[model samples]
Target: MSELRTLYPVIEPYETGWLDVGDGHSIYYERVGTPGGTPAVFLHGGPGAGISENHRRQFDPARYDLTLFDQRGCGRSTPHAGLEANTTWHLVADIERLREKFGHEQWLVFGGSWGSTLALAYAETHPKRVSALILRGIYTVTRAEIDWYYRFGVSEMFPDKWERFLAPLKTPAERADPVRAYRALLTGTDETARLEAAKAWTIWEGETITLLPNPELTAPYHDGHYALAFARVENHYFYHDAWMEDGQLLRDAHKLAGIPGVIVHGRYDMPCPAKYAWALHKAWPDADFHLIEGAGHAYTEPGILDQLIRATDRFAG
Candidate 1:
């Protein structure tokens, strides 16, 4: 499979310090390219993590002004995963803060996986402020979505992996109570439990994202400090019904229906299935959807990443 794209020289990169959001929480971010270009904000996946250097390649820097940052408690962000100021609501607010800070009344929003969900939520909440969307690997964060990941999503190919993931839960009740199991592993002082949970969580996430048998080059963002924060915060939202009623997006698609969006989904993506994308496109019929055959959930997939970057560049241009 094709590897990741090399960072473009035209995409000038610069790091900014931090933005304090109170409660001892701060977010880190960086900007690239000329400010006068089309504004595009890159939202990296992982609720716990921040933007990656590779994320910069999503858009050709020369065409679009790029702004990428770690959310609160993510990479480069201060007070890693500080629970006091972490939530979907907090993240949405942070995006708004970035836009106001950069003086972009409207900008393109790009996201994948959980990032796609966040970008969609933000656009829905502030449709007038967003120019368009370039989303990949859409994840809905519903119980069905999580259930698909844990049980139905990749169990056939990764049965052993799933077994290990669910090994900690002895009974059906405990398995059903994934929230409790996840909470204990994250917050409990049990080192063995935490480590086991971390390994299981990371393995499932990593394995599901790719099928390439290869030398592991990049670190799974899920294994970092942001992973913990993302899991906890994501679980909080998932437990609370993702704060979206069944028809939340469908009910609100009209706000974003006329807005332009180029959506990319992998045919074999197990982490977040193609079904999610199909459903989303049905909700917003005008959005463009490109189904990449033979590709899975991993952004590193050979043709998928470059094609997505190309789409971003086109939009930015």
Candidate 2:
């Protein structure tokens, strides 16, 4: 039997600071590992979800010059949860700005979920700047993918949760388009309605994100601030389709042809079906693909984490 691959030891960043990216956005960034090492940047999931120190542990402290940053309106970045000028294009530009700020010619890009979407966009726009990619829970932010999770597809598997997710919508029209309905409440002026809608939206996600149900994670959604930002940002991006043309990422796969990369996906991932990963592999056959048999959407799942660690170890050079 193969031994389980674990994350490198917990390591603290030697440097941490904010990068002023203009437009009233100052991104929070940290550098871990040796001062001079293989350059790698961790692109966190959630077009709005931010980074944590645990993200820094994904790389070898001695071999990788790991950098992690909270994108606009996320984590420790200023103007918390501010969405102005925070489109996908802005994010791609931010990645480049970070690279230029750090003076690295090229660096490995590691991302998951929405991060995968941004990674693809960044690599396509600035191919020469990305040496490789390590994507997990692959999401292209296409209309079909968004519709699958939010509209009708995953509902079949979790009818109860879906019903609870829809409880906030009173009218048939609102129920007909949950995405738009939730978006209205999230962006509405009524703070109570917004927080209520945010809780309902977040609870539905927590319930379905994993193969086995864990209701406890939904507890965090009670914090109106966290719930508001997470739900609002996610809904905003999904509503706009991450501001990309239909099937744009798959159409742009040619740009990643020579870039060595790995796609780590859970076989039973509900938030993002495995077929998306399969489609990505078909488009970019050069990239290594691994399907963890007993995992779900979380990158920290045992099997998924092991595979991610292995991929990073392989690319540590």
Every model's TM-score: 0.89, 0.96
Residue 40 displacement in candidate 1 (angstroms): 0.9
Q: Give per-candidate clash totals.
A: 3, 0
Task: In model 2, state the lDDT of residue 51.
Answer: 84
* lDDT per residue as tens, model 2, 133-201: 999999988788888888889999899889999999999999888889998998899989988998888
Q: What is the lDDT of residue 121 in candidate 1?
A: 84
Residue ranges of candidate 1 with Cα displaced over 4 Å:
1-12, 170-172, 214-218, 221-227
The C-alpha lDDT values of all candidates are 0.74, 0.86
Q: Compare the candidates by TM-score and give the number of the best one.
A: 2
Q: What are the root-mean-square deviations of the candidates from the true structure over C-alphas?
A: 2.9, 1.5
Root mean square deviation (Cα) for candidate 2: 1.5
